[model samples]
Target: MGLLTIVTAAAVAGAGYVRARDAIVQRAQDNAVIETTNRVEQLYPLPARVFDHAALERIAGRVSGREGSAIAYGDGISAGGMDPSVITGELRSLVSSGRVGWQRVSYAGAVWLVVGMQLRITADGSSRSSGVEVYVLRPFTSEIEVVNELARNAWLIGSAVLILALGLAFLAARGVLRPVRELQLAAWQLGQGDLTARVPVRGRDELASVASTFNSTASSLEHHVGELTRMEADARRFVADVSHELRTPLAAMTAVTDVLDAETASLPGVAGQAARLVNRETLNLTRLVNDLIEVTRFDSGTAALALDDVDVAEVVRTCLRMRGFTEVSASLPDGVRARLDPRRLDVIVANLVGNALRHGAPPVSLTLSVAGSVAGSSLEILVADSGPGLPESVLPHVFARFYKADSARGRSEGSGLGLAIAWENARLHGGTLTAANRPGGGALFTLRMPLGGDA
Candidate 1:
């Protein structure tokens, strides 16, 4: 914008300068022509009456004294202060055509206005040339200087106007962009979880309308999010309450199932089979209730880590032994000790091995290693089973609660909460659990726990 203003102002200034120069030169020429014509009229009658060269030179000297001019008589004698050649051919031609004329010419690094007139007299009632030619040379350098000064002033004013316009445009843009910048900042804050973020409203322009709409939308979003958060909290509290409520009765039922398990083998054929079935179902129910309790603890933020320095390989061996997962193979480092929650680690291993045993093929593998540096080291555990690998669509949601890969098999041996509980336990120990397909055609679950004892 500033550049455009400067260019436009320059063009206007140039045009103004040209017009002003032409007017100044024209007015100067007109004044010079008038003065020369008056002098010529005053001397023409004298030259017409006396045709002698010496007398004409005397009269011309009297008429143009000290001025740079030239006079020519009919008999071809001439007198002037200016060079005779300074009277151009064009001017002489116009005078010979019996017309008063003027022209501007440059000579000796100076500008001059030349005016010419031809004198005539009547003889025998016919008009004939007396051949008294008068020409005047007037310096126009001073008038040109005045015009140049005006042009300089025009350019100066144009530059000042351009600068002023640029300043005003910047101020206006700043005023417009300030509110937009504020809106951008507010949007970034909102995206970063600042629900109360809002922009200020200033005026009744379109920008003000945008600000007002932004505030309105922010308020509505904050209200809706608050409601959603409250409802989620209520749902979690309800689940936690129900889990707590069921624990007492579930304990009594667990005691009854234990007694039945002891008597199942001694009972008759049909009765024994029914007893075993009841015992198995009762244990599955107990496991489900226990898993629900653990999930509630995780959700309520009450789950905490109890870190201990333990050999990771020994812990895996002990968990596999307790779970009777004898067919699963283990590849562990000799004495890979880490600062971790031993109980949580046991839970994670049990769930992964149990899931593999129930849903995966035989020949499961557990690999444990120490990873990262001493200052911020980690324990990485990979549990894989030689089963059909997880479907591509189900792999991402493997750790979600109650997600089943084989939805057609609605009644599975273990509760769906196993992997979810394992995932929460891993996170409680400042670790992560990720599931993927192993290259050899199996589901792999990897657990990484920070070994810094910070959990």
Candidate 2:
């Protein structure tokens, strides 16, 4: 666009230059013709009466002797190589009615300005046979000089116009591109997970409209995110409060069961059954309360890790012992150290082992290893069960809070919060937890942790 503007200015200046040069040339030519006529009338004064050839010759000789002057009349000055007599006769024939005449002539490939005036030369009061005519000539070089000056002025003006035009174009481009660059930066920030990023609205123009649109979108996105966060927080709080309320009664029931178990031998059948039911429900309620508390901590951004370096193999051994996985085969490498909050680590490992034991065949397996070689090392733990593998539909939501495979299968003895708590613990440690149906008829849960353990 800048180049095009400059070219357009140049074209306009060029046209103006051509017209100015032509006008200069034309004016100079007209002035030269007037000057020639004046010189002729001044040199050859008109007589009151007509004169013969002899009188005309005398007047022509007087005018020709002056510098930068010439004469052409009806006489021959043979030695001067100009026939004054021949030109004098033709001029007399044209000027018989007393009118001025002009003509353009060229010699030596150059144009000349010529003007003729009527001159009657009389020696006495008596009229002669004919009147005299005087002619003047000048080269067109003076007119050419005027045109050249015009051309020079035009060239300078064209250059100045081009420079000014380019400078303006540069400034305009910067103005337009500045807002676009801001929009680009805002878009990049939004893409990189900054939902609050927005462009500033400045003017009531197209760029302002773009900025307004971007700001509106950012506001909407922030509102939606805040709404979702509030909803989640409210749900977590409700669950935590309800679970706390439930735990009070369940604790009371558990105390009553303790008393009943003490008197179990005396009461025998029905008493034993009632105590078992109470004990089972008390355990379930306890698990539910713990899960609710953990979920609340996560929601309120208070979940924290008490990280310490411990051997992964040792942790796995402790977890399997606690969960009673005596028949499970375990593979672990030495020097596989990981930093983890012991309580959260216990929860993660206990859930993995419990889930496997409850659903797996006799040969459940646990594996632990360090992931990287020398510079960096991450702890990777895998628990695979040889149970009937999870279905495709269930695999996606296996770690979701309170998700169950099927209600028709009935609730398992385990709370659904176990895997969800494990997932949150993995994330709290800056680790990842994933589940997949194994190639064989089983399922696998893999947990990977960072090497530094500071996350």
lDDT of each: 0.82, 0.74
Could you give candidate 1's per-residue lDDT for residues 46-118 as a string of tens digits? 4346567776666566556354565655666776566666778888898889998888889779887777787
With a 3 Å backbone cut-off (N, CA, C), the pairs that clash in candidate 2 are 73-84, 73-88, 74-85, 74-88, 75-84, 75-85
lDDT of 2 at 94: 61
Error of 1 at 270 (Å): 5.4
Best by TM-score: 1
User: Over all chains combined, what TM-score does candidate 2 have?
Assistant: 0.66
- Model 1 spans with C-alpha error above 4 angstroms: 1-18, 46-78, 83-135, 268-274, 300-302, 372-377, 428-430, 453-455
The runs of at least 3 residues in candidate 2 whose Cα sits more than 4 Å from the true structure, single-residue gaps closed, are 22-148, 163-228, 258-274, 333-338, 392-395, 450-452
Question: Where does candidate 1 have its weakest 10-residue lDDT segment?
Answer: 41-50
Q: With candidate 2 superimposed using the best TM-score fit, by how many Å does residue 398's alpha carbon deviate from the native? A: 3.1
Clashing pairs in 1: none
Give the range of the ten consecutive residues with the poorest summed lDDT in model 2. Answer: 77-86
